[model samples]
Target chain A: MSLAASQAAFQAWLQQADDAGIAPTLADPRGLSVYQNNYRVSLMACLSEAFPHTLAWLGAEAFEGAAARHVDAHPPRSFTLDAYPQGFVETLRAIW
Target chain B: MPSPHFGPHFGLGLRKPHYADFLGGDVAVDFVPVDFVPVDFVPVDFVEVISENFMVPGGRPRDILRRVRADYPVALHGVSLSVGSASGLDADYLRALRALVDDVEPAFVSDHLCWTRLGAFQSHDLLPLPYTAEALALVCAHVDAAQMALGRQMLIENPSSYVSFAEDEMTEWEFLGELVARTGCGLLLDVNNIHVSAHNHSFDPAAYLAAIPFDAVRQIHLAGHTARTIEGREMLIDTHDQPVPDPVWRLFAEAITRAPHAWTMIERDDNIPELAELLAELDIARDIAHQAAADHQVPA
Candidate 1:
């Protein structure tokens, strides 16, 4: 595939991975799995970084899972990973 | 102005895990460098530093930026500026950044040399850019524009990348050197990032530090990275989760030898420990930075 076409396909696969935009017709869905994992981990990483207290408050498994979900729902649109997540205390209360 | 250069001081990346610890006056961190919102907007500690995380306005985030700036030493770091892009500058982003900078009046400003926007679409991640001539011009122009907007010099940092571009024209060392020479901006040197990039791209860590114009370096960043050997090629992803590794410490020591008193910070975005633990690491950094300065200085 051309670079532009590949980029477009990749974008479609990425921005709407959850949606039914693209179907899985490759050798394996490992790349998509890795993408989702990285996305989840990155968001989780940012939340945990910004809110170490929350990690202590929620514990590792619960906090990581909760943060992973929260970030998936409300991912940062900006480019900088330094923009740590907020409103987690409330998010925790809302979910947990 | 601000300290004008980085110094051996202790600070904390304001985290929610220690919110009650801080609120109840249990943990005693000196400078609290806060995240985007939640931790920043509400009435938390007073001694806070604001990265570009708090740049975007409105909602709880912007409100927190104002609230935190009212009391603490707000330092702005822009991760989205994409300083190393060959495409062009994001004038709108710069204007928004200018507005935010004016509002916060931070202690210092900073951003990474990685690109986020390509052509028109901006990525949410700090995607790596080619270390080339086109990249250099785009970055210098963006930095110059950032300085113009904020009316003060900002700190540009090196990024850790998993991939390198094949169409590069110049080197990161030369690019950063020329950037400091042309822009008069400060360098937020991340020793861990240097280590990560060095391992990923087979370069002498000492040579990288020796290449930087130390005087232009204003702040330093130390963080933890996870190693992944991709396709038999070693790659260290700058995942700031755990403790600062040993080789990164070595690189940081070398970099500080060049710039003795740059504002030093440790970025831990995940699996954070208590304020006491983080502060302990910061204390260790201070000692090492001091030792580096003392050991490198010539008896004149």
Candidate 2:
């Protein structure tokens, strides 16, 4: 695969855990799990930070569940992670 | 105003919890939000801010940054440069950053060597790049483009990575050395990142430090990391949530011994403690750098 394709495959795996994006191309895909974890954990941390008051109200378990759902629904499309929280309140509204 | 040249300065990442300590007035002594504190309260040579935070139209954050810059030399560190992207550098992002640089006149502008964006999707996390000749050329071109846009040379920081690609050509250090040679950019050597990447990839941390272009290094980042067991194997993550661990401190001693002139700072994003705690951590860094300088007979 080309460089762009390689990165796209990596991004695909990171966002969707679709190893088929790289299962054929990669020699060892064991580390992709780490990247996936980093992606989710970072976005989750962003949500937890951006909505601290909400987290305090919902508690860690509920807040993390909502954050994971939001993360799965929205793969950050902005250059800054600060923008990722723009529509997060709607996620909470929809869930609650 | 005198130009801000990078010296062997000790500093910390300006987090929200410590804003009062940084911008001093008659604020509360505890971690409660306050209007301000004393200007010279934190006691550091410089302060580093996330460039994207102030990369906005006039706001309270910009005002606060300006106030802080009046007291300390500010360093603009970015996360979304994505210089390693195969697509190219984002023009709009560069323009926004250049505006901030023009406003701040910071001590330095630095971003990670890894890519965080591709096409419309911005990962917001430092992702690894294949150490291939093609990637090296692309990164050089992007760095050149970024420097031209900013009207100054930017410092490229080494990122901690969990994956090593199959199409790798040279080592990460070799890629960085070549990048510096091609783009005339300086280096921000994150010692904690080196330790994390070294353990995750099973490479010798000393070897990585030795291969670094010490003369080109302008800053050093000391941060904490977390250890997690993935698939029954241990892996280190650059979480930056806690204090700088001892192993990273040892490697930093060696790193400072080599790159004595680099401005060093500690970065703590999540679970940020009080300003005094970070200042005390900065003291440890000061001690290490002093010992290293004294041992090497280099000016501290």
lDDT of each: 0.66, 0.87
Model 2: residues with Cα > 4 Å off, grouped in runs = A23-28, A52-65, A92-96, B1-6, B25-39
Model 2 CAPRI quality: medium
Interface RMSD of each: 7.1, 1.6
DockQ of each: 0.13, 0.62
Model 2 per-residue lDDT at B83: 95
Per-residue lDDT of model 1, residues B123-219, tens digit only: 5556555565666776788889878877888888888765555555676888899898888887889899888878777788788888888877777
Structure candidate 2, residue pairs in collision? B24-B37, B24-B38, B25-B36, B25-B37, B25-B38
lDDT of 1 at B276: 65
Task: Looking at model 2 chain A, report the run of 10 residues with the lowest lDDT sum.
Answer: A22-31
> What fraction of the native interface does candidate 2 get right in terms of contacts?
0.56
* Cα RMSD (angstroms) for every candidate in the order listed: 7.9, 2.9
lDDT of prediction 2 = 0.87
DockQ of 2: 0.62
Output the lDDT of residue A36, model 1.
43
